[model samples]
Target: MLINCVAYQEGKKLADIPIEDISEYLSHPKCFVWVALRDASPEELATMKEEFGLHELAVEDALRGKQRPKIEEYGDSLFAVIQTVEPHGDELTVGEVAVFVGANYVLSVRRDAQQGLVGVRARAEREPHLLSIGSAFVLYALMDAIVDRYFPIVDALEAELEIIEEKMFASGAGAQRDNIERLYELKRKGLVLRHAVMPLLDAMGRLYGGRVPVLVENCQEYFRDVHDHLARILGRLDSVRDTIGTAIQVNLSMVAIDDSEVNKRLAAYAAIFAVFTAFAGVWGMNFEYMPELKWHYGYHMAICSMVIVCGYMYYKFRKSGWL
Candidate 1:
């Protein structure tokens, strides 16, 4: 669905134009048309292509969605794919935004992403000085908006790792188990956010230096700012991944330690039982040569001996911290 189609000239809004009137504004010097679409259909993309002279491959990629985060240059226009990250419950939901930017027009198509660029448009219009740079500034604005959204997710993942670390030391078996699962889940989300941000680092470099796109030549600093944000996000993602890996290993070690403690207790109990069994097995044997059985106090003496020996063993086990 088309969200908004507005035209701008001299860094100010002209009017909200219909889709059919996009070409007329495109022809005007110092004017650009901005169109926003949500889950755009192929027919809509085709019409956009016709209006903005968008590359066929770019339109195809936009219509299909699910493209890896990237920026590609086709002739005089640029196509960029950005992944949108949003928190859904305890999980992260990923979406895509495909932008087609030219000297005279900008088209943004969003898919599976709940958040839109309405704020970006408003901010751009409010800052006419930057918006006056033309379509490239719009591209930078959209990229900057998407990149900014990633900071909260990175912080959330970091917070989750800290929680899991605390649980690793303080929680019981069941809670620790849940923490391990939670850690893995957060790691997965971090990776998803990483994939979304990592590719843009290199792709965006082309916009700032060395044969830079004409529309972005004067806005190198803006593009560079976006790159720095992405780099920071990628760095934090790496840290989160390493921390999660360490947390998982620590959790496994805790499980092993618990198992070892259980084994020691079981072994201690078995040792105590073995002492009594040994005494009974010896006394249970029926033979003519059994001299202790001939005495009346022999039965009482044997019972006392068994009890004393077992008690001694129990005391030793307890003192050693095994029971």
Candidate 2:
């Protein structure tokens, strides 16, 4: 799908191009275009490659669709690959965002159509005035929303970390184990997010660092805004990493405390049983002249003694907080 954003002044649109094939309109500096393509087939890639003079290496990366988050200098244009974040079940999935950017236009392609440029497409359709800003500004707006998705996901991880912190004490080994797994999951997500966003910061820096043609200056502020967003995101992810470390430590301490309490209870039970076993063992030595054998109440007295010893041990254990 194409979202055409034409340049404007005094509430007028001058020229327009397919939002997905914007590289074609770069010759006309008075107007700019942005094309957002998704799941482009091999034929589509061929057409795009021909139109943009895309390097074979870049096209190969785009077609194969597993490129790491990076920016490649292609002389007149720069090719970049970034990830689009989405949740798939309990874990998050990274969507590839490929772009072939030139002097006056930018072409963005996604690995799948499911998440292609719907948000940006909607914005352009809803507000025709955005076309007046130029290609760089439109690219910034699309990329900005893509970056913002990281914040909420990170916030969710933070909230989960807080909950796990509270339960880490009272929970059992099973719960602690689950929390550790969750920590690893959160770390993985953060890494994925980092892969998706961190490169764009450098890409933006390079773009606005006087590398691009004069047409992009109009959109420098927007790219800087994106960079600031990324910086804050990176900081937040770092904080979560620290919190995960603390959670693991607390969980370990709690497990140790739990084990100690259990051991103390077992020891108390063992002490109580030891008294009964000793009393039985001593009295069971069937000797002909045993003193207890001569007494009628010896059996009753021995029973009472055993009960007393058991009760006393129970009381001591309770007092010592070993129960």
Candidate 3:
């Protein structure tokens, strides 16, 4: 669906133009058209391809709608695919935005992404000097907006990691289990963010320094800023992943410790009972020649001996912290 199609010249808005008028606006000097689409159909994409003279391969990738985040050059024009990430309950929902940027036009096709780039256009209009730089500026603005959104998600991931860490050693039958599950969930979200950021980081890096795309060559600084933002996000993502790894290991260790404690108590009790059983078994074997069996106090004596030995063993186990 077409969200908006507007024309601009010399850093200012001219008017909202019909789709047919896009080519007409492009013919004028210092003018360009910016178009936004949401889940565009194949027919709409084909129309856009004709209007912008977009490369067929680029159009096909956009139509497919789940291309890996990347930047490709087709002569003087640039095509970019960036992933959009949003937090959905305990999981992260992934989306895509395909951007076709030329000297005089920008076509942004969004797929499966809930957030719109309206604010980016507004921000660009507010700063006419930057908008006047042409389609490159618009591309930067859109990327900046998308990259900025990742900050909040990083914050959320960090916040969740801290919460889990605080409860890492919490005492309960299910505490460690719950934390391990949550850490793995958190790790999965981090991986989603990593998959989104890493490719863009590599793609954006090419827009600045050394060899650069002609369309964005003049706006290298802006692209560099974007590259820096991606780098920051990547760093934080790595940290979050590492912390999650350590947290999971710690939770596992806690589980092991609890199991060991249980085994120690069971072994201690078994040892004490084994001693009592040994004494009872020996006395139960009646031998006619056994002198103690003839004494009237023999039964009491044997009972007393068993009680004394079991009591001593119980005391030793308790003092050693085994019981």
Candidate 4:
């Protein structure tokens, strides 16, 4: 769907023009048209291709959707695919925005993305001086907006990890299974973020310094700021992933410790019962010639001996912290 098609000249909004008039605006030396679309139809893409003289391969990638986040150059124009990530319950919803930027036009096609770049256009209009730099400025604005959204997600992930860690430690050997499951889920979310940020981090590096793209040459500083933001996010994401791994291991260790304590308790009980069983078995043999069987206090002596021996063994077990 076509969200908006507007033309601009000399850092100011001229008017909201129809798509057909885009070519007319392109003819002017200092004018450019900005277009936004959401889940555009194939027909709309073909029309855009003809109107803007977009490269066929770029159009195909946009039409196909799900292109890896990247930036490709087609002559003086640039095609960039940026992934849009949003937190959805416990999962991250991944989306894509394909941007076609030329010297005089910028066309953004958003696919499977809930949020739109409408605010970007508003902010650009509010700052005419930066918008005056032409399509490159718009590209940077769109990318910056997308990259800025990543901060909140990273913050949320950090908060979640802290919560899980606190609960796991506080409960100490309790609910270990649940803690491990939550940690793994948190790790999955981090992976989603990694998938979104890493590729773009690499892609953004090319826009600044040492033979940059012609369209973004004048606006390298803005793009560099964006690159820095991506780097920060990537760093935080790596930290979260590493902490999650550690948390998972700790939870498993707690489980193992709990199991070991249970086994020790069981072994201690078995040893105490074994002493009584041994005494009872020897007495139950009932040898007719056994002298103790004829003694009047023989039963009392056997009972007292068993009690004394069992008590000593129990004391030892308790002292060793095994019972």
- Native-to-model Cα distance after best TM-score fit, residue 16 in candidate 3, in Å: 1.0
Candidate 4 per-residue lDDT, tens place, 107-212, comes to 9999999988999999999999999999999999999999899999999999989998888755546688888888888888888878988998898888999989
On the 0 to 100 scale, the lDDT of residue 182 in model 2 is 77
Candidate 3's TM-score reads: 0.97
Local distance difference test, each candidate: 0.90, 0.73, 0.93, 0.92
Model 2 lDDT vs. the true structure?
0.73
* Residue-level lDDT tens digits of model 2 in 1-323: 33334433322455554435345455555544455567777787787677667788888888889777776777666677877888777878877788777655567778752455667655754555655665555566677777887788888878887887777766577777777777777778778787776777666686565655455566777777878988898888889888888878877777778788899999999999999999999999999999998999999999999999899989989999998
Tell me the tens digit of each residue's lDDT in model 3 across 44-95: 9999999999999999999998889999999999999999999787778999
Show the colliding residue pairs in model 4. Answer: none
Over the stretch 182-244, how does candidate 1's per-residue lDDT look in tens digits? 988888898889889888887988988788877679889999999999988898899889888
Q: TM-score for each prediction?
A: 0.97, 0.84, 0.97, 0.96
* Residue-level lDDT for 135 in candidate 3: 96
Cα lDDT of candidate 3 equals: 0.93
* Candidate order by decreasing lDDT: 3, 4, 1, 2
> Candidate 3, which segments miss by more than 4 Å at Cα?
none
Error of 2 at 225 (Å): 1.7
Error of 2 at 244 (Å): 1.7
For candidate 2, what is the TM-score? 0.84
Which of the two, 1 or 2, has more TM-score?
1
Candidate 1 wrong stretches, greater than 4 Å:
none
